[model samples]
Target: MKSYTIEEINAILKGELIGHTTEKIVGPEELEKAQANHITFIGSSTYAKLWAKSKASAAIVNETLSVEPGDDRALIKVKNADLAMAKILELYNPPKPHFDIDIHPTAVIHASASIGKGCIVGANCYVGKDVVLEKEVVLYPNVCVFDETIIGEATVVWSGTVIRERCIIGSNCIFHTNVSIGADGFGYRPSDDGRGLTKIPQIGNVVIGHYVEIGANSCVDRAKFSATIIGDGCKIDNLVQIAHNSVMGRSCIMAGHSGLAGSVTLGDGVIIGGSASIKDHTTIHSGATVGAGSGVMNNVAAGQTVLGYPAQEAREMLKQWVAMRRLAKK
Candidate 1:
C-alpha cells in the first residue's frame, strides 16, 4: 500500500495545508467510510459540514468551502476538491492487467495484417486480413479485429470487443470489454412483393478520435453510407448506444444507458444524461444538456438544458410540473 505524509500530499495537490502536517495518509476513502489513516474529499458544502464528524485524518476540501481541520487532523484546500481527489487516486491506482509484448500462441494473425512494435495480442485474439495495429496497441483475450481495421498507437482494447471491417480507431483510445464497434445499423424496408421486410445494406465504418473511452458493452453502429464519427475526448458510459451516421463533436459525454437514434448530430460539449433518448435526426447544439430519462423529440438550442418526456426547456418543464402538482392537490 502507498502512503503519503500530509505535507507531501499538500505539495502534490499544490493546496493550502491547515492543521497537523505530519499525519500519514495510507489511502483515499469515501467520506462516510474514512478512518484515521485514510484521506477523504469535501467537494460540496454538505460534505464540508460533515467533516467535523468524519474520522478521516486528512481531507482535500474545495477552496470555496468554509471548513477547518479537526483536532490532530489536516485539511488541504484546493481549487477543485474533486480534481484533487482524482490526482490522489491516481497515486494509489493498481497496475492494469499485464500482457506481454509478443502475441500469444493461441492468437491468429492473418498474413497481410500489420502488428506494430510493442503491441500485445493476447490469447484467442483474431487479427483479420489487412488489419493494422499501430505501435503499443494492446488487445486482451478474445478480441476480434475484422478485415482492414486500423487501431492507432497506444490504444487498449479489452476482451470480447469486436471491431468490424474497415473501422478506424484513434490513438490512446480505450474500449472496454464487450464493446461492439461498426455493427450494421438497424434499417429495413418493405419488400416490393409485399411479403417480407428487406434489410438495408450498411457499408460505412466507425471512426473514433483520440483519447475517447467507451465503457463496457457500448455499441457504435456502422453508417449506411459514410462514417459514424466520434470526436476527440468523448466519454461514453456503459451500455450506451450510438446509432448509424451520428456525428458527435469534441468532449461530448453520454451517461450510462443513454442512446442516440440514427443520423443524430451532437455539437461540442453536449451532455446526454443517463437513460435519455434522442430522436432520429435531432441536433443538439454545443453545450446543451439533456436531463436523465428525457425523451428528446426536437432540436435543442445551444447551451440549453432540457428535461422531462418530449423534452422542453428546463424552466418550462419545472413550471409545468409545479402547476400539475398544484392542480392535483385541489
Candidate 2:
C-alpha cells in the first residue's frame, strides 16, 4: 500500500496537473478497476468518453482529449498521456531486484563452472561444467544452462528455459519461460538399411546478441557447424521456430508462430507477421514486412511488403485474387 501524493506523481512524470494536489496515488491500473489510491490513463478520445464513470482516482489524459473530469477524479494533462502514464508506472512500481548477492541452496552449479559476481541461480536451476554466467545474471527456477554455455551480464532467464551446450547469449537479454536455445536442429539422414532415419550431429551452437527478447516457448536451433545467430535488439514472439544456421539481423521483429527454415537470412529491421513461414535458405532484405499467414518461397527485396503464399506484394496478391475470382465465375 505504498502511496505517493499527486504532486509527487506529477514530478515523477514531469507532467502538469490540472486537478486537486493532495490526492494520494498508489499503483496504476485500468480505469475500470483502479481504486481510490490507483492512477490510470486514457489514451484516446474513445476512452475519454468513459472518463465520467471511471473509478480511478486520477487519470493521465492527452492534451487533445476534451472530456470533462468527474468531480471525484483528478486529471493530469500531458502531451502523450500513454507515455506519461508508462513513466509514472515505472516510478511507482520499479522492477524488483531478482538476483540476490548469493546463490540459492537448491541451485546446482558444477565445481568446474565459473559463475561471475552478482548472479542469482534460483531453486532447482542447473549450471553445468565450464558454464560461464557473467555478473548480474538471474536464472529463475528450473532453468538449465548446459556445458560450455555462456550467458552475458545482466541477462534474465525465466523458468523452464534450457540453454543447451556451447551456446553464447549476449548481455541484457530476456528470455521468457520455456525458451529453448541451442537445441539440436531437425536434421536427419536415411539409415544404411533404408529402414529409419539417422540424426545428424548438431555440432554448432546459438548466438544471441545484446538486448534480444525471446518470448515463451520459442526455440532457436543449433547449427550443423556454424552458429544460428540472432542479432542485437531482435524481438521474437512466442512459439516462433528459428531453424539451424538462420541469421536474423538487428532489430528484427518476428511475430508469434513464424517459422524460419534452415540457412535463412533476415536483414535488419525485417518484420515478420504471425504464422509466416520462410523457405529454407531464403533471404529477406532489410525493412521487408511479411504479412501474416504468408508462405515465403523466394527472396523479398528491401523495403517491400509481401503477402500470401509464394509471397507477392500485398496489392499484387489482392489483384491476383480478384482475377482468380473472375476466372472462377467464367
Off by over 4 Å in 1: none
Give the Cα error of residue 88 in candidate 1, in Å.
0.8
User: Tens digit of lDDT per residue, candidate 1, span 140-181?
Assistant: 999999999999999999999999999999999999999999
> How accurate locally, in lDDT, is each candidate?
0.96, 0.91
**Winning candidate number (lDDT):** 1
lDDT of 2: 0.91
**Mind giving the per-residue lDDT tens digits that candidate 2 earns over 157-218?**
99999999999999999999999999999999999999999999999999999999999999
Per-candidate TM equals 0.98, 0.87
Q: For this target, which candidate reaches the highest TM-score against the unseen true structure?
A: 1
Q: Where is the poorest 10-residue window by lDDT in model 1?
A: 94-103
